[model samples]
Target chain A: MSARFVPVPTPETGTYWEKAAEGELWLPRCDSCGRAVFYPRSFCPHCHGDDLTWFRASGRGVVESFIINHNPAPGYEQDAPYVIALIMLEEGVRLTTNLLGVEQTPDAVRIGLPVEVVFEQRDGIALPQFRVITGDGASG
Target chain B: MNRAAGSSPVIIAGAAESPQLGTVPGQSAMMLAVSSARLALRQTGLAWADVDGLASTLPVVDLASYVGIRPGWLDGTVVGGCSSMLHVRHAVAAIRSGAASVVVVAHGESGRSRVGMPPRAVDPASMAGQFEQPYGMSGTFSRFTLPVLAYLHTYGLSPDDLAEVPVAQSEWAAGNPRAYRDKPLDIHAVLSSRMIAWPFRVLECCPLTDGGGALVLMSARRAADLDLEHRPVTVLGSGESCEGPGASFMEDLTSFAGFREASARAFRESGLTQADIDHLMIYDAYAHVPLYGLEDLGFVGRGEAVPFLRSGATRPGGSLPMNTNGGGLLYTHTGMYGMFAIQEAVRQLRGDAFAAVPGVRTSFVQGIGGMFGAAGSLVLSNT
Candidate 1:
């Protein structure tokens, strides 16, 4: 069976979800501070500058860190065990997503694993995920 | 350098914990917090009227205000596990600045007993909720598993090495009247327990405890006036640092840079080295935290904490008597074990611990806030 379904989004963050629906990872870059910000916001957290603009990302990054979850969360009981990873975008922005297309084991995942973005549709929402690049020995 | 040569020093006048934790039913989070606060005041021979500034975790903000403390400069820092330690540091600052002569830092959580609080909906556009939570990183348990598994692989340490922590801590708890899990757990029993996550067993994880703890900090001048039963444990040094709210921002999971920096600042400000600490009260939300904390705090070299534990360096009368009150492993972990470490450190300095280490003139306490995201350290000396 598929996992429990829910599509929850708020006005402040609706722009982010809207962009993701088009297969685009739109992150806000502060016009004043020149820092790329994730998790959509109205103002730059760094300089509190209101001048912000959304930009598309390269969608390719290295797996800076990851966790092989043996236990599942309440809503994610169907997928008892999965791999959750923190991907460091080439733009210097970091985002967390599930590492798909790889075995969920300690031996399978390692630091500096090269991965590219893949979108998983859930409840009509395109959720960003990652998979190990083929031929990459980093994926054990 | 003598800002106030003979000014009142802020000290931990008293500390206390709720009676029934881990399995208590029908007790609201506020009730547990109030009980601990009252007990702390009683221990210090003071009353609610004596407190002017209140510093505490976010969960107990309304409760603290209801207990007759004016909320002029109250701090409800919600930094996950290190909530209480951060509150302690804020309390010291409040007392020193004369904002309020007497400050209380308290925390409590009723995680096991359902409080009927609504689950907060995730906003996908928000930085954390959008970027991290959707990918299945819901809580600290899931996030912490990465570094823990990696540490095991890097060190070639077996689950048995991890089991020793709960085993030894449970043995310490057997002697602690207030510890929730007082039964002596053998290594075999610990290893045999069901797994909560890979490399972490049910025994290895802390219980969803329902408890509260409180500490009172007063200016040095005010501390001298009170007819205290025990000498006050002075806060020699304190420091805090944050690594943002995401794991990706960190440079190395194996080495907790924030904790290392905080510890260094605390030790330097206190003019004490690792060798000077007679006892330690490092936070142990999970078995691996103490191992990593020791390494990050310069107590042990990198990848060497496992061997140090095997050598009995952390047990009572060993090289360093750590977490003598059973820690969160055997004690109660109300989601914020960092505050409990501070309480234990004060108890040790005041010579009131169940397994009090002799000549404990100095004590070191370290707390991890988020998944190694933030850290707060304190050095207490009976000078």
Candidate 2:
């Protein structure tokens, strides 16, 4: 079986994965349709256009949804009770990431709470995670 | 035009579940499939030679050769949990197109026995792994349970509020003799159960087991020709749809577009409204899935399912009785629970279900694949 902790990037998504290593959120944009494409795809899902470009993201979004995992997730056992969230970015894209700097309880983490990206770099890999912005930005 | 709204052309003439569900210690997955296939064939009183169409998540060649079937048409649409439901739709289309008759859709798994399944990563090197695994995430329970948080937060429901799902489903299971656990379930028991994932206790998840199920769908002519004691169940409407393979690609976490599209097309095809449905079965992979399934199918408005279920709407004696076979939660899951869903629907329509719903003239069955990657729904009526 393949290792679950490492990334398996293809030519299409190499740029996006490499940018994550540089502590930045970069995604592709279709030049033909002017629609943002996610998951580092080869073509625009909206227009099926092949002309795509990459750009850095604003790294700001709100929590659309999330779940707290109290069980072990292989390498993430120590991080039990972790918050996995679907963060909807301002650029109209949504991706899955962890919620940091917040209590693991449901009352602490909420939908529509404003969050910002935080990069975690180790073992030559950098991943973008989300943290609920404290103070005025925090809804709950 | 979809066939359901136009004409009802297919009839489910035969259906069977493995005689020994929960487990068959020595049997391989193939043995389970063949056993169920043989049982269904006997029910239809059709010989193996009469089977012209074959479908399953397993390779058709493996199951066919084992069962000695030389199918004229085959469908290998394995979309995780919804595979069998999708196969039924594919078979309906093929039967209508004059491609074949007497289509047998089967699903067999030894998830409990681990007889034929391959070993994979807690998280694999698929598209999901490439994007999310680098962060050290693993296992499906956590990844799949993430939607409940969204559901709770969106609807202002608490984790305890969601506890009603498994509790009520267990009540129905209590009446099912074949159910894995028929003991009464309560919100207190569910909330205090071991937390596999926060907000999702062990009871909220389906128990893995070993079993197989098969359904025989024949064209109207072939079905009419069948000389069987069991009443035929007509396929009044059927619909199947896929939303790719990635969970993060979902436009809405709390609701599924695939479920909505498939069920809408199914009801439209059936020419039946929500009030017309007498029974319902949705793949209960976890506690949150039913909530999503109910809302997406428009059985209830958004933010209505949790409260509706809490009000005993899906309880055994309640209006719109659901998952009467104890569902995947208390009943047998056997990896893909879709086949079991179909089997229960058939039994309920035949008025022979162990946890039978009274006078089930119309049943709507939905099967979900992956983590909302695909979904298929069917409207069945007693013939």
Candidate 3:
């Protein structure tokens, strides 16, 4: 049986998947409009420019908000309740990521809590998750 | 205190539910669309031949072929749940511009049966599939549940306010015979219900049901030419807009700007204000939706909806009566719940809804598609 579900990456988004597999977060930077694109787009969202550059991100952000799921997802029955969060990165963009190394509850998770990207490899595919850099259990 | 009450070019001649709601067996999604269209056409005293235009939330070519109406004009706008509401707006534009005379807007969703849209075998593939889905998250329950915490924390609200929404809507549902849920729901029932996600109980989510609804629209002049039994509900003004692609892109998680922009355009075009509306229908797929709608639509100030809701302003005999169809929470939510709101709006204007607000001259319906992805607002009136 497969350890996890890995999405078949499109030509446009395959770069993001490939970079994450190498333990690096590569975001698209628009040469024309200078806007940072997420989910690996083909064109610059700011100017619709096709000319874009890839750069490894600082991978630092804070929790804008989060929710703890008590229900089971399709591929993750053993991990019923987990924290899904919108992390506002230091580069002024937000992305959805899982908050790890903390209690998966509201009391444990607070808005503006600092987090850092930590990639976990499952079946040779790297999935990006967040861990607390500074919080109630910062040292933990 | 005078408002625009602007003249409208088009009016809804008739509308109908699929007549087969809840667990509709063996009926495919397209089948329900055809059935609902037929029901609505019957109400208008028109035949399939009179349908010169057809707008569908489903695949337009398939539904058109299935309904056997080769329309002069067809709109297949598939944004999300609010697609049907935009269809009404688009249909009006189509007719007023001499695109088509008689227009039929239909919605058919087999949310429970999963006829055409099969249940997830593999995980969904989208932006969310890449980011949120991998983290034991994905599905309507997980997507919508993310907003509650931000809303509550931003507004300094408690769990009790969230619990009160479904409970109050259930009271309205109890009065509606066609409402899907027969079991009584209360504050304790909602809060104590199984927590699907943090701060969202199972009762807070919309039930998966198989159903459809449709509307038959024509020029106001055409409505006056015929002796219609029901009051002709005019489409005075309509508004629609989309914000970011997803909630993650939204700057303010607490409020939806799309709802505000859409509702404002409708009101501004109609020359109306929040005070002028006698009734309202905000899509409540979950309890927090109404909270977002109320504040965003300018019915109440930001953070004022909780107190307003607690005051029962949205209940029966209130100043601003809303969601008399029991909403998606208790009433039939065939996935896209917008048309049900339109059905209730038309019924209220015709003076024949189960929980009708007294002297309802104007009804405003707000249709939400996706998680703040799109919105459609319509100002419907009998005047």
Candidate 4:
């Protein structure tokens, strides 16, 4: 089956997607205020600091919370019954991503479950995802 | 800001709402707004010509102009769901500054019945359309649902725990003659309802309504001198804050900073705390919105709202009478839930609500806009 998709990249967030392709989560850290920022911006919104740095993350976190998708959007019909979770990084940042490699039942994906980052190849690009870090040797 | 000598005190002189607003067919958006405006003017013993300031949400900009006097000051604030509360706050400022003597804030929409207004053609060169829309994060429901699910997971709360808010609010609605959903709902009924997106069943979501809500704010001097039998309610304090829009940029789904900031400012200005608020009219576009808002507003400790709700603190006649007018869950939600909060607060203060509570001298109303990205809080008092 052929899946049609497109990626729209902006100047501010282009580096983020590029780092994700290489199996890394890149966030802008304000040099002056030392805060990790998202929605990638050129300057720090908090302190208006121009000094910024891109750093790699450990890619390990727990599910802060999640919702199961029973009604998939039009283009995502095939991916019905998926789990969308807010994963809280150890560094105190949260991002939305799909939890793959498990049943999308509410009972199966409890809140605060341990999760580890993984990537999937979608339309020649690597998209970040997460899966439950089961102790039973099931690793994505 | 210094108040002008001749400025009005900005009291809620009148309020009116349309019946069964969202599901009606053949009713235009303009008609809904006009009917509510007329009802409010009649209730306040004022005429259309008496209104000098007109404010409305983006959905009904043109319609507001068509139904009222030519406003010397017009404010069309479209900050998503909290638009009405922000409008109320702005109206108070305008009145105190002597920019307008009388202001009317109104909203109405057939959001549930309408489908597919053609998408605006954004510049292909624009980064926003290219980056966000393609990821299926176009609508407010989809974006807000993501954080709600996360909040549920982290708290170890079941769907039933989240379901209790709507179930109890619907029960309150059952007693309200104007509530759209008058039937009582149990926890089981809420859990068994069709899932819109996993943990959020149909009952957890606010209905798409086509109703109109209007509130008339006049100067304290003018309200006191009016020959009308009903006394107006005073605007004690108001506060507003806006955060980044997208979910990715939010600090935490469970903790909305905007609400916290706005609520603190409102409470500080009003010289009241959670203990002082006898009534609460929280914005409830989704059941979870109020759950988070309660925590942000310092009514309960973080992650403790579920139990606070379970113990029935938010029910009618409880320690805190909350959403006594049925709220957005059972009352009509025309995209913006802010108007309903203002209406409920004014009614409670005036002792004119369908589900009026006794000894309600002070009331608090909170409105959430744009997936918890913005918040507007108000405190009203009979004293």
The digit string of per-residue lDDT tens for model 2 on B320-379 reads 898888889899888789999999999999999987788889999999998788899999
**What tens-digit string does per-residue lDDT give for candidate 3 at B72-161?**
899999887788889999988877777788899999999898887646533335665666556665567777667677788888898557
TM-score of each: 0.86, 0.93, 0.93, 0.88
Instruction: lDDT for model 1, please.
Output: 0.75
Q: Write the per-residue lDDT of candidate 3 for residues A1-140, one digit (tens) a residue.
A: 22455556677788888998888887888998787887678888768898989888888888887777787666667676878888888877788877877787778888888888889886667887889785454542
RMSD of 3: 3.8
C-alpha DockQ of every model: 0.35, 0.58, 0.56, 0.42
lDDT of 4 by residue, B1-383 (tens): 24331544568877887655657666665666667877887877888888888888744447555873578888988887788888888888888887877888887765665432224333322333433334334245555777776676577776668788887787578856567787888998889888777677878888877777788888777666576545678788889998766555567676888889988988998888889899998898888888888899999988888999888888876899898878888877877778877888887888888787898999999998876678899999888
User: What lDDT does model 2 reach?
Assistant: 0.82
In order of listing, the candidates' clash counts read 4, 1, 1, 9
- By the TM-score metric, which is better: model 2 or model 4? 2
lDDT of candidate 4 over A49-117, digit per residue (tens): 997787787677888766776766446677776676778876667766778667878778877788888
lDDT for position A10 in model 2: 78
Candidate 1 structure quality by residue, lDDT tens digits, A1-140: 44633346676567667887888877779999999876567789779999788888777787765555666755677675777777778778777777777787757877677787777888788877788887843432
Error of 2 at B148 (Å): 2.3
Q: Which stretches of candidate 3 lie above 4 Å from their native place?
A: A1-3, A31-35, A47-51, A134-140, B1-8, B116-125
Worst 10 residues of 2 chain A by lDDT: A1-10
Query: Model 3, B174: alpha-carbon shift in Å?
Result: 0.8
What's the interface RMS deviation of candidate 3? 2.1
Name model 2 segments beyond 4 Å from true.
Answer: A1-4, A132-140, B1-8, B122-125
Error of 1 at A29 (Å): 7.3
